[model samples]
Target: MRDLFMQAVAYTSMWLAQREVFAYRDEALQNWTLPGGVEEVQATVLAKLRVALDYARSSNAYYAGVFASVGFDPLTMRGLEEISVLPIMTKDDIRRHRSDFEACESMNSHRVEGKTGGSTGQPLKFSMSRDDYLRSVGIGLAGWHFCGYVLGDRVGVLGGASIAKQDAVPWHISRSDLALNRRQFSAAVMDDNRIAQYWDYIARWEPAYLRGYPFALAELCRHRPKGCAGHYRPRAVLTTSEMLTESDRHIIEKALGAPVFDGWGLNDGGASAYECREHIGMHVDTTRAYVETVDDAGRPVWDMPGRIVVTSLTNKAFPFVRYDTGDMGVLAWRGCKCGRSGLMLTQILGRCDERLNIGGVRTEACAGSWLTDIDRVRRWRIVQDGPLHITITLDVDAGFDKRASEEAVTLSFVSRCSTVSIAFVYAPLPLPTDGSKWRSVVVLDSARHQTRVVAEKHA
Candidate 1:
């Protein structure tokens, strides 16, 4: 009865909210449309960008300083092409001035707190209002619904949050709003025993959709109990967090006997992009977010690959205007045949910080192409210490050609970092962070020779 009442309330609230959004949609559709028709969406995004810039300049101290440094007037900014004039904000900038990121109103009353965590292990804290939280969730749900999920469908989420301590028995399950309709199993504490227990729980519940970090789901697929396939088959498996390698997708799809949809988002609780049934590339939510790709010089790069910058359209409580997410990808001009009009993200190359420093030269897309290329390798990590020294860890079949593989990897490294020395070693897999997410690459300064295991299998 209690669950039914809560469901009713959820349904009613969603209905009312959707009515308002649809009203906005109808009015907006008179000019623009969903999936973001290029010309119309571009116009909408430009207008929002101007508004967001104005809001940030006036309300966010961090952005105010940023704009002043670049000598760019937020009000007078014209089209996306001129975005190069604005200085690019990186993760380091946010970490150093965490307090300045908040809107003045929020800072004065302490109405919200800020939070941050991306490919970079450095976590940040920020603030937002209750309304901001709800809006974020609403936009996320809209994307899920676009991918065929409904409000009441049971979902399974495998993630990491420091909610429970390690070795806790019977893994406590809570009906918190944060968990929503999903049964969440923390990958942070994953072990053979815990994963077996999680599988038993999943068999009993038989959720409709499975969603979580790709690394965890891939680990689960690799180590699940034999004959467990008969118990349940989710309609689809959605992967997020870590880079969804083709091997990981293959493992997950084979285990669940279902299609795997890839998604990209941020801790700010905004859905940057989601794959439709077509599965070509993720469709950007142009109505509520504006995304741009910029080069290292912070200059906008259109019709080419570059770093991703996102500005949230909503979230007046804590504006994320022109926030550099540190991710590298391209905004392709092509649209999907699925009929959605939002901008399309061609690819998400790893994080800027995740790049391996081969000698003095930095490298990107190493993990995706090399470490994840071998089918038998379930998990791996690469740590670069200075230009000369590096280590490679692997979780793989014992029969793997370690000698040849190492030589090939060394050759690749030499090609990228011509004068650097290379080292390779196989170690026991490490564990995921508190969020059940994996790090593909970790950079270590030569001054700090501290050996830290960085990657793990996420069962």
Candidate 2:
């Protein structure tokens, strides 16, 4: 039967992915697996960082010049702080001089080009060796296994199709998916008809696991039309690209009849954080990349939110050292009950693009300062429309001070922000829309791949 054939293909794909990840990973960075105690993990990650640094120093012209100018030596580094000696990479850096970042020796080497997907609305493209690409995918597979997946099991993926040939998946579906035992549905387009089609795919594929952007899955679940029977009961649903909020998870589980787990990753950073069976916090893969949270002065801050900077240990092709991810988070070293030795990222607050730059006054961390004081108000969302006009919606009970609440909310938003006509409404919490992921702070005109409308309170 066709079903049996797909399962066979899936098993073959897993076998190949496993073989490719481990085999080719060493071809770039030896000892891809950084298993063992915390110190061992730290040592392994640092060693790989040096390997990538050394390669970049020699084969990457831009880094070489920058290192020479700064007189920063990766091989003879004084401490981890010395890494801050290297210039921080940003999207603007990539945009300004993309080719300079490419490994000088990659002229004839096989490579895979990828783009970063987050709130910035603009995506950056970078290249890594084809083998390194497989290695990252292998790590992803390992994460999936942690959440209850076996090689060759039927799987379904929901992702926005870029619509352009360059954005279109460059790989063969059957050769990869059939061999990998998975299929993909378009998350880019989510009309009712598409939802119906997605349901049909699930009923036919009967996937053991489902995965995709959190927003896409939530939309499908929200707009699930009646009369379609989805017999496919996945053991677990995997969400990535965007943070999964507690409310979003509850709704998804209710609709799909499956427990949900989250995958945390940055496309350009080559790092991943995934939840285990314990489901407490995401176990970050420090082996592939080193993660740090630093205050504005570039000092590490604990128990407080800071800018997330990442250094890719595995990416020698374009050693992204101390890359300012522009996202905010807090990492906890107290550890987790899951017994995973790797470092854990306890919180990822939101992306820089998630901030409401009302007239220029940032209202992310301080928005709650004023909104919570309003009487009978349960929650509030700051929605930014195309013209940057603001709308503050409050969820309140009967018999509340609407006028006072509006004044407080407006005062909170327009603190120093430029002139703006604002709208205030009292209603229930706004549910998410399929067109985009939900955001407590939204720019109706902006979609930064990095924004998280909602996520598990704990993560």
Candidate 3:
């Protein structure tokens, strides 16, 4: 009875909020998997691209000026191949001309704001129309469906996106979350005790899907209670936000007793690719955004590694044409084993950023993210130059607690890699002045003794 009630509430709320997503999701389920749907999908993409170009040229000042500067008109666009003539857009361009990117009519209207938890440590903020937000939600739901998830299904999300830790409670659920059958588990510094608590919740809740960062899920698998495997298994484990490696996948799948499905998407741009059951490669959702790979000179490449570029066809309010994602991967025009046709991001070679590999356990430097909440901590950076040595640089206020902060930072890393040593350095302001994005996590190349100094703008 309780499950039925939650389902009713969830679906009813979704219908009231955005019924169009369901419609699109249904169409996607058919078009993405059908044998002859590739041609139809391609036609739809070209039609949408044409409409998008026209809309942007008239409604967006930025694109209009860009088209004028290039002496290119949207009317002359004959094929998707012709899109290459337009200049590529970069993150720096967005940062410099954010206002001009938005549609002139939506400047004063209400919209949704999106900020990416960038891997390079520089957050990019953008706005989306209410309609586009709803469609994106629908598109994401279709991806979830590929992994055997249904609407209103219970999901245990273990990520830093939303911290749910209370003083006594390891996990928290709000009323809305309960209605939607969702629970958030904090991805912050996890020790045995915390992992045990998280596992306890998962065992009780019996979520149909486990979704979160691969690194956090692997930590949970590493510390799960003995004899816990095969006792409780979610339908599938959906991992995103970080690169999912084979080793991490093996660890998570072994402990959870379920297959791991890797996903990649841009938070700010809404372009996505998800793995189907066949698991050959992630099928790109070309219906929402146009995705392609490019060489260093901004020319398209195939069957080989290059940079990933995207153009959001759905985001009319903030149009992004040929936006460089600063990530490297391969885009193949091959068919998947799942019968889904169109484009597939065959490989994700980027975002395999440096990690702290100590005592045979590798972990991300997301501890620096949690430090932002510490009292008097203005900014922080984590640098790993040796296999067992880590230096944390803190730019803090006068009231900072050096001993307590060190203890907190130490616990975060030592809890994962017990053999590593932690040190601290105080800095007033050490940001680069030559206009370069700074990364919070810096991992030096021990082979050549070269430090990859990642910049972080002092706030």
Backbone clashes in model 1: 13
Ranking by lDDT: 3, 1, 2
TM-score of 3: 0.75
CA deviation > 4 Å runs, candidate 2: 1-8, 13-18, 22-36, 103-108, 162-175, 230-232, 357-381, 384-390, 393-422, 425-440, 443-459
Total clashing pairs for each candidate: 13, 18, 3
Task: List the lowest-lDDT window of 10 residues for candidate 3.
Answer: 450-459
- For all candidates in order, the CA lDDT equals 0.67, 0.65, 0.71
Candidate 1 lDDT over 412-449, as tens digits, reads 77787677676666766856645545877777755133
Model 3 misses residue 408 by how many Å?
Answer: 36
Error of 1 at 317 (Å): 2.4
Q: Is candidate 2 or candidate 3 better by lDDT?
A: 3
Instruction: Kindly list the per-residue Cα lDDT of model 3 for residues 314-334, writing each as its tens digit.
Output: 776677788887666888876
**Which stretches of candidate 3 lie above 4 Å from their native place?**
1-4, 102-108, 162-171, 227-230, 352-459
Highest lDDT against the true fold, candidate: 3
